[model samples]
Target: MKLRIFHQTVYRYDRPARNLVQSLRLTPSVSEGQRTHDWQIDVQGGIRGPGFRDGAGDWIEGWTVRGPTEEVTVTVTGRIETRDTAGVLRGHRELINPLAYLRDTPATKPDQALRDLALTAKDAADPLGLAHRLSAVVSDAIAYMPGQTGFHTTAAEALEKGEGVCQDHAHALIALARLHDLPARYASGYLHTTADGDAHEAAHAWAEINVPGLGWVGFDPANRCCPDERYVRLGSGLDASDAAPIRGIAAGHGIETMDVAVSVEEVERFQTQSQSQTQS
Candidate 1:
């Protein structure tokens, strides 16, 4: 599938920001299922710095927007060709070991409840099967309610509430996966959901578990399925906050408000078909 994506994030502050520095993991790395065509991130009134890929296999770029500034806008536009690899991340290179993800983060630390829930996912079956079982366990426990939780909500809190958005699901899944000693990390990306509704939509999140032989396989319990062609995998880390697409600090802030708008859509069906044929 061929898709076009547009994402804009704007920040407003009560007081002017003295200075700002942002690290962006906005570009998707090449894997078996997807390849970026042309992508650009434009930071209004910002100067670009050297960018490099981190040990986790994500491209990290630095940008500085000098302030005395009240607002900052970051605009991203891109085109990518994606294939359905059943959520398996293939042909991706990274320096970090899978066991590195075993460490717990504040947001994904499993509580007793999560530990007990992890026991339910255990099986005498294969490790891959057990992972899928855990995914189902999380899916059955949490219902998708967008406004039910906030960004700071932890996996245990979201599970206790029994409701949260995709980020919550990813966090909860990571917690459960780690409870069983499985190496799991949080993945941030864009999903082509609006093509189904004919409207613009938001970004997407999921969990990737490193199975014995499977390497990294993504599972989105919120959707009750793994990522497919509709999904675009970006950076990954120990948890949501670690894998955030954009992470930064603004100096001299009274109160900062952020607004994000994302649009993802498949190119025309004919265009998709033509692209596929050319590649084949």
Candidate 2:
């Protein structure tokens, strides 16, 4: 399937701020499952900086706004041709060892409850099977309630509350996967939601576990499925903050606020219309 994406993030400060710097991991992953085309990132009134791929094979770019300004906007527009790869991340190059992801972050640290949950899936025969079972257990344990959790909510806290959005689900699953000694990390990306009235978040997240032979495989417990053609993988990190599409800081504390809008849609219909118009 061919998918088109538009994402805009606007940052507003009540008082003028200064010297803003941003690191963006907003590009789609280069893998057998997807191929990117015509991608662009624009930051209003900002100077583009150096870009490089990190050890985890994620593309990162830096931008700076020499601001005594009040507002900044980041816009991303892109298209991707995607295939269903059964959630297996293939043909992606990285220097980091898989075991590196076994380390924990504040948002994914497992507590006693999480450890107990991981133990339930201990009887699984192999790493891949265990990963699947762990995802299932998390799906059943946490109810998807949008406002039930916050950005800093830890895996243990979300599990105890029994409700959260995709971020919480991914964090909880990562924590559980690590408890079983499966190397796991948080993945940030976009998901195409259809007209079926499903409440899937267009800006989404999932957990990727590095199985022995398979490398990295994605599991989204909030939706109770593996990542498929409808999903576009961006980057992976220890947790959400580390994997955030955009991370930046302002030199002056001017009390900032942000608003984000994202949309992902299949482009086949749009292409067909363009073709018809050209022929006519």
Predictions in order: lDDT:
0.90, 0.94
After superposing candidate 2, which stretches have Cα over 4 Å from the reference?
271-280
TM-score of each: 0.93, 0.96
lDDT of 1 by residue, 1-280 (tens): 8988899999898999967999999998779899889999999989999999899888999999988898999999999999999888999989999999999999999899999999997773987898899999999999988888998999999999999889999999999888888999999999887444422135989999999988999999988999999999889999888999999998893799999998887888658779899999
Model 1: ten consecutive residues of lowest lDDT:
193-202
Q: Give the top-scoring candidate (lDDT).
A: 2
Candidate 2: give the clashing pairs. none
Range of the 10 consecutive residues with the lowest summed lDDT in candidate 2: 192-201
**Model 2: per-residue lDDT, tens digit, 72-163?**
99999999999999999999999999999999999998889998998999999999999999999999999999988889999999999999
